[model samples]
Target: MIAVGDKAPSFHLAASRDRVVDSGDLAGRPYLLYFYPKADTPGCTTQACGIQEALPQLGKLGLVVIGVSPDPVAQIDAFADKFNLEFPLASDPDHGLADAYGTWVEKKNYGRTYFGMERSSFLVGADGIVKNVWRKVKPEAHAVLVAEAASKL
Candidate 1:
């Protein structure tokens, strides 16, 4: 997995049907790049909502939150709308970005094995270096933890 102090992987993906968010968009700004397994799921919803609720403080700290998931634009759109999520959520439907960041991995559940995104997050500093990383994150309280980290940045 990518670690703190490593340079973050560069990526460009669809944030919506018509909008694209790229690594360059995070230039000169500290940002949170989070990867969740799926959209509109219980855990993902909790994390997104927590971040949404903390936007004002995060904005004051000059941090931007960008979430990525292996879901299509339509599904991402629905999720954002349903939760009133203001942050941008880019789609990584092919797992390209997830793999690049090392968040894609093999897993076994209920005796079935498969490859999928592991819940993770990265705090990319304004210099484009990873300042912190969280792997296999618990959905609850994650946003709050990330927010505290952003404040320190």
Candidate 2:
């Protein structure tokens, strides 16, 4: 996974509807880049909603939150709408973005081995250098942790 002091990889990703979140546009601003296994699933839902609730505070701290998942645009759109999520939830269907951040990894579940996202997050500063990282994130109370980190930045 991405670590502190690393320069973040640039990206132009699709968000809900016709919206797009581009790294170029977010330059000189602190932002949170998070990876979730899937959209609208139990754990993912918990994390997304928590982030949603923290949006106002995060905004006040000059932080933008963008979520990434291995689902397609349609699914991401549906999930955002269903949950009333205002933050950008980018679709990374091919896992290219996840690969760049090293969140796509090997996993063993139910005696099955596979490659998937490792619920994680990165805090990128205004200069595009990663300031903090969270790996194997727990869905619950994620917002508080994220907020605390952003406050320090």
Candidate 3:
């Protein structure tokens, strides 16, 4: 997995509201890149909402938020609309983003095993270096914690 001080992997993803968010364009700007298993799901929804609530503080810190999931652009749009989320909820249909960030891995659930995205978040500083990394992040307090960390950056 990408760790603190590592340069974040570059990506150009299709996001909600028919937008495209690219790492290259965010150069010299701080950002929070968060990976989730699926859109509109319980945990994902909670995390998204929490992040949305933190947008004011995050924006003041000049930290752009980008959410990534394995779902398609259409589904991401639906979820964003349902929650009134303002940040980019990107689609990673090929799992390339997840793989690049090392969020893709073997997962076991209900006596079954499969490949899926691990709930994680990366805080990248203005210089494009990863400032902090959170793996298996708790959905409830993730945004608050991330904001606190970003403030330190």
Which candidate leads in lDDT? 3
By summed lDDT, which 10 consecutive residues of candidate 1 come out lowest?
Answer: 16-25
Model 1: residues >4 Å from true position, as ranges?
A: none
TM-scores for every predicted model: 0.96, 0.97, 0.98
* lDDT at 93, model 3: 92
Backbone clash pairs for candidate 1 read: none
**Candidate 3 C-alpha error for residue 151, in Å:** 0.6
lDDT, candidate 2, at 6: 94
What's the ranking of the predictions by TM-score, best on top?
A: 3, 2, 1
Clashes in candidate 2: how many?
Answer: 0
Order of candidate numbers by lDDT, starting with the best: 3, 2, 1
lDDT preference between candidates 2 and 3, better one:
3
Cα TM-score of candidate 2: 0.97
Residue pairs clashing in model 2 are none
Of models 1 and 2, which has the larger TM-score? 2
